[model samples]
Target: DLDLSGTVGAMLRSTGGTSAPIFGFGIVDTATDVKVTLNDTNAFMVKGSVTEADLGFDNFRFGIDDNAPRMIFEDFGGTTWQLDSNGNNFRFFQAGSVKMQLASDGDLSLENNNLDNVGVIFLKQQASADADVPAYGQIWTKTATPNQLWFTPDGGVDTQLDHTGAFPTTWSDTGITGAELETLSDTSDADSLHSHSNHGASHGNTLDEAYDEGGAGAGRTITVDDGSPIELIAAGPTTKVIDILQSGGGFPELQLRPDGILFGPGGGTPQDISLTRSGNNVLALGASDKLTLDKIGATTGDVLAVQSTLKLAKPLVLDKGTSANIDGNDEISIPVVTWLYLTSAGATDNLDGIGAGTEGQVVFLTVVAGKDITLVHNGTVTAGKKLMINGEATVTLDQDHDFAIAIYDATATVWNVLVPGSGGGVGNHNILDGSVHQDSVADGVTAGSVIIGNDTPKWDELVISIPGANILNVLGIANGETVPSWKSVLDGTNPAATAATASPGTSLISAHRDHVHPIGVGTTRGDILIWNSTPVASRLVAKTAGAYVGGDGTDVVSTIPKRTIVLTAAGGKEATTAGCAAAAVVEAGTNDVDYWVLDFDKDTDEFAFWNIVMPGNYDGGTITFRVYWTAASGSGTVVWNLKGRSYADSAAIDQAYTDVGETSTDTLITAGDVHISPESAVVTLNGSPAGGEYVQIKVNRDISEDTLTADARLLAIEIEYTTDAISDAI
Candidate 1:
């Protein structure tokens, strides 16, 4: 170890040589204690634990020249050394196999780098050892080609490997020099080898002859022996006993041996034995073998006698032959029993056997058979279907009373009793005698009766009887007749009859015509007959006047004062003395009714009035009466009496008619003109009015001038006029 304790500048230096172990180096002030400096202002200090021995002097400077080996302290522990080059650290070790390499960042590396060889190196025993070569536990090797290791022994007493063959020869123990012999021994049975003579004999090859020939010691044979008859006595438990023995074989017969099996102590008594085979290999004991109790004597309580008062907590039953008898007197004994019977002969009389003492008391008896009860009643009896009393048992209803019976159906529901003959008779006949009583009230008869005369009468006959008349008296008449003859007597009074004659004493009025004549009394006419009145006309006219009236008779005869003379002229006395005596005679002033005198001048053939006082000229008035006029032979216009003025000029008035005609004609006046105004006359001009002077004017006539001749007759006159001109015009 080189110590740089008091180095000032350079302790060791070397110039650059070709084979020197250094390049360049410098000292770093790696002091942790005091700051070191090359100059006073440029000082540096290291970081870590430090001592004075860590640095030679506090501020000493150390350097290495070129080609010089420099020492380096790698770690502060001071056990490692490294080389220095230009202030970089390179670790080094004294052992070459152990290396320390420094990384760029000052990390150290210590590793071994080597390669192993390619073949197997086995640690084997020596080939010259006389002892057997020990085997090494299996060795794995690698080879370039497929190969194997085998061992082959040569022909010798001792086994040795023979190498005379190829590289992979098999070495077995055959034909080996110095080879030991392989011996096999069965060590499990060492004595089997010495005992081979007794092998066949031990496996049952020998036998005793006596056993083969059925001697006393032969193998047991399956056998069955008839068992000795046994006595079975059954005693202790009960007086009666039964035992059973099973049999095997062909009928499997059961035998009741006379020496019955004994049971109980010493088998003193033998039980009655019986056997019966039922089906399917089963056996049953007969009735004789059934256990039965003996009837004991009275002292021994034979009938299970209850001497004291025995109260039965439950129902006591005696089956079949079991019975009981009462012995003591004054005994109010009671025993609950079921299915007990009381003696009776006929069921009909049995109900009476229940004793009159139990009257009005309810008793329950269950009958085993149907139709078991027969009740006889002298009074009304109602029986349902379940109460099947005998037929001869009369159920009489002595008096009028209502009876009802209800029958139960299969479901035990009671239904109303249905009476026979409820439906009407067969083939629509009347069956039900509902009239059992005269005033019987039958309700709910919705259907009408079919009997002919009972309810419904024959066609058209009244079913209801009329008072004071028998229903037979009603007549059956066909419809649409006026009066049907009465089949029975008519009552009350008779109706009146009409007479057949017109005269009172005409042969006793035999077939006399009583014609229905109609006569008009006032303004009405209807059926009428002769009444008690005067006769206005005779029946037959007599020819007592000798000659018949030549024409329609018209003769007048009167007695005048003696101045009456008969004046006869050439043609007719046409007022021959027409103007001989004429006077205007105006009668004394008439009140409102007056007669104006007018004359027709026959000589002049004109109408003339003598002292005719005409009324005032009325403006509008109508006149209706008979007016006669005749036209004389004339060819000029004739002016007749007129009432209206002229139509052209109101001043022109005419008392005679104005006319206009085309021919010389004569006209007759029938109806007057209707004057509308005083100036105008609405004239229906009849025949043709003459057109010029000397023409005739015919007014109020219906004759056509074209068809009329000069001999037409005139009739009456009628006219209509307006009364109020001003009001009527509007």
Candidate 2:
């Protein structure tokens, strides 16, 4: 709202210091923003994190969007820099001309000074194929045939030069004739061959016979036998090596010897494997005696199909393994060993992956100690590392005695996991059935010791079976309990017979200990009580209303229900006196959820009154109130600062009240919200709260200091007090 007072112009004068603002709204802290406070020079400065600071207060955004224009930066030392949009591209301009542009597809373009071109210029000219010929004696390159250097020798026609980028052009100015080059090609190797390029190798006539390591070549042949041994290779009379090698890995190199068989690593020492060829098979050694490897079929793929059965009399060793702690990533570098012991977590260790494996290789890992391992199935993808565990079913080795078995699938570059029972994995449990693994496991606690137990984690219901009929007797004597003394006077074999020898006293002692029998003194039958023979069981039932009494037969009779008074806004009304602002009750919602809304404004203090009549069974104690409310609109912190004037009777209704009573502050995190505050701390009712009397509660929204930007719609209030009986008549 504005009133200009009918003046020809409008001007604002600062009422206080230079920092005082003349006009603004929606105040905030000064770090991110500041008001337009004018100074004596009156430069009219306002720089914030926005194009204009006034827009954000009205729910409008302040940053770059569809409404903002291009930003420009000017330098007094030289020119200007601008950031603007070029179609869908972002463009940067220097000195009113485009300098750079970035496309949306991530392509960048740098521009030159010329408006038509976008490149730099050197001393010599770089011309295109469609470009005009250069000036006299000037060297230039054509874009289409750039490798061919050209120059205007006489300022008219271009002189052709070599097309290659290598130094000293292929054609020399002191040219040799084709007839002379042909004579050099056939007859000379080093004589014309630093020489071989200008002529061919058969006396240089052909380029085909010139030899390097690239392709299969034509060569000279020499024949030699043992008696006529000739020098096959020599390196200028010095000792040198001549190697016969395959080009790369996976290609095999074979050497044939007529009389000897060698077994050794390359470049090291060679030894003879002490075996002789028997009847179409290799000689006997280890379990692989007379080992014969045969192919399955032409259609079947195999690493090496062993058609012969192999058996070993001695125990096969798995690995020379010790307990090794894995890394934080649960990774370990597994050697070519067949077994690994992964246990006793040092710091943080849980196996997730292994490294270094070959095709068809089996591995067994012992997962023990306290740390459990959850496999990251199908995940062992680190650079240069080649071990992964992939399985259709999830596996977790959680017990202290568990082992994992897997085989490397080098084709898929993943390890195919397997269950323990299918292989020779000596774990202490069975994977096929939930049975205890009775294998002798090496005890990690003591080196070289074997331990056997049922360490598998299985806890199903256990049932015991008996062989005979129902004639089993139990010696039912509890620890620290004694048998009754009068039981000794009865027939020792048949205590069930009429024991009129004298009835046993109530203080019967245990069969073993001299402790007295403990019981609670209550008479009710269905009620439960604690053991209380002076000092016994210490357990008390929580009573809400009635107390425990010794009923017939010393039974406990306790009650457990708290009496509550729930007040709704439909039962409340505004104050009827003058000079008091009151809230109006409005009905809200349909069948979904209906609330009798008592509106409390956020600017002024509004009051609502409700008078509650106590039941005759009321315990005459202090009462507490729990209020439920919702916001009308907007989201912010809300303060429910209300004090109840609980005056019953004989007091003036217009008397002054206390400054502040019960206060609760909360937030409407989701804009329109509902909240139920916890019960207010011990609000004592006025004039000795008793039966048949009324206590009037006056509630007001103390919104003079609250930040809630909207009205607070009250839903309901709960008034809770103690009760000793069920009804007023009692």
Candidate 3:
């Protein structure tokens, strides 16, 4: 081997010439392009001084094959170097392994998942990029919002690099790293121990300068933009899910993952958030969402909320959802997050339950006037639709002006009423901010609605002004004390009752509760009247005693005046066997006219019991029932004994009957004749009978005292009791 420079010595003979050069065969080219060719299985090589040296010797070779060209350099050592041009691509090989490739389409590919060996050096560009795109734009597009770095920028206005962008090598080969990214920096030194001329300070990957306070690289903000979501996975390498954990110190962290956005308190217990969709949940059973439906097994749609309160600002409005009876039943339903615009029908409308309710949900309900809706506490309104209001059953939304509030309980799966609904627009006011007049009281103020001074949390005094100051003077009153009278206002010496004569009052008087005006009108004698429907404009009906105010079933209630009510024996239950009074029927002609009766055997002395709820209108007194029965065959005097007990709410249901019953003797005048017995003396109830309480009355016949040989077919019994109202409060 000879090393010669600046000398025309012959080492290679020109293949294009017929003759060789003297001294040494060499080829020289004066043309603009020159070519070197080696046939197959031949190589232009350089080797150590060894005879007949093969590829195993320390040598380097520039070889050619069928449409392939490669240059290999080896020193009898491992993984030297090789550059090959085959498959129309440029590849660098180390130890016969492809380390990097420059594709024909101008892409530089590194075959690794990490750039750990790469160092922060001068950025370079790929000139083969598409003409319209920026240099290295093909790879930079992956990072839509590229990261910025200050690897080793020279400070000053005339610095070569702007230091506005960075070259950050990620864990994937598709990401470009060595690109000459633009960056902005005052001073930076890329060397491990060198100082920058601009700042005279050293900064590198060393621990001493890594987190220097107030340094360019210290406490800098890193912006992670939203593109194809950035995911925070495990510290180790894996595409599968593995929890990113803290040291169990209970630090809060939010992370993006395959499942969804997860939030973990600490110790690796990350929770996925569930977002709501418009349609009903169609998630599979045991899926993260729709877990509430899986829990309660309810087919009705509901909202599952994990938070406590849903607050809204003032003037808050919502789409009014509808609520009505379910298929003519007493049950109803309205989605959780909504206000109810309710409509109802029925003489005694009942709202026993609400459906489609979720745990920790609140509901508001309203009813119009005359639409009586009673929410029964512990009512029998089927499963998945149950409620309890104040532990009592009188929760009725009686008016339209009022609304009810309720909360749902998952464990009990029932709505617990917070504010009981009172139908008919007659409940506590839903107060809002407003002003009320506090001026001196006037005469005309007693007619229409007005605001007045009252105390509230936000105001000193403000409330609804009830026009009732002088209501008694103008209110319809009967002749005696019922309606207003001219004598009430005219005072003494006022003329007697005359149809249309007016006797004006001598002096004015301040209105008082008992101040009845002596007007020139009269009314009927009965309990005060109550409106059955919304009052018509200026429609004045004279006060009548026929209709009294009552909140029970929809019916015009009236004062009994006689203090007596009659009930037949058919409404009572019979005892068993010897003491049981059985029901018997009688058929007359061929058409079979049917008539029902209670037959008490003369030999057994059977008894019939009547379970009664003393009407709300019942005035408390001794309740006496007479047995109306008939003789089927033989007849004699019949002795009927009455005994019973009353059981109020919470009273012992099995209380014993009265010690001694009142006995009445009635003799049968003729066979098959209806006999009347004297009213038995008032029999005392064991539980101290009272109005609106439950009473069980048992009537029996004494066989020893009665000579009736045949069965006594009892027709009916008349119960005598007094009522002070139309009916019990509904």
Best by lDDT: 3
Off by over 4 Å in 1: 1-427, 431-527, 530-730
TM-score of each: 0.11, 0.27, 0.25
Give the alpha carbon lDDT tens digit for every residue of 86-149 in model 1.
3354655433333555767644445463425698645333322122224321222222133222
Model 1 residue 136 distance off true place after TM-score fit, in angstroms: 77
User: What's the lDDT for all of these models?
Assistant: 0.27, 0.48, 0.51
RMSD of 3: 28.2
- Arranged by TM-score with the best first, the candidates are 2, 3, 1
For candidate 3, what is the TM-score? 0.25
Give the runs in model 2 whose Cα sits over 4 Å from its true position: 1-535, 538-545, 548-561, 577-594, 641-660, 728-730
* Worst-scoring 10-residue span by lDDT in model 3: 189-198
Report RMSD for candidate 1.
46.3
lDDT of 2: 0.48
Tens-place lDDT digits, model 2, residues 1-730: 1213323223354443444434322223434543332333322333343323232222221223255345555443445566778678999888778888998975566676444547873433355222343432435554433354554333233433333322222232112222223333222211211111111111112223222211333222223333443222322332122222233312232222322333333332333222335634444576545443333223423343345775556566554466656665667765445566665455224455666466776778666556555545555545323335443434556555566777877777667776453222234433333323222232223332222232343222122222233233232334464431112211113222222133564432223232344343434544444554343433445344444344336544354234677777777776664212334444345445555767777777777778777777777776677788887676665555444444456766665555355656666665345788767776665555676566677676767656778877777778777767667652
Q: What is the lDDT of residue 363 in candidate 2?
A: 76
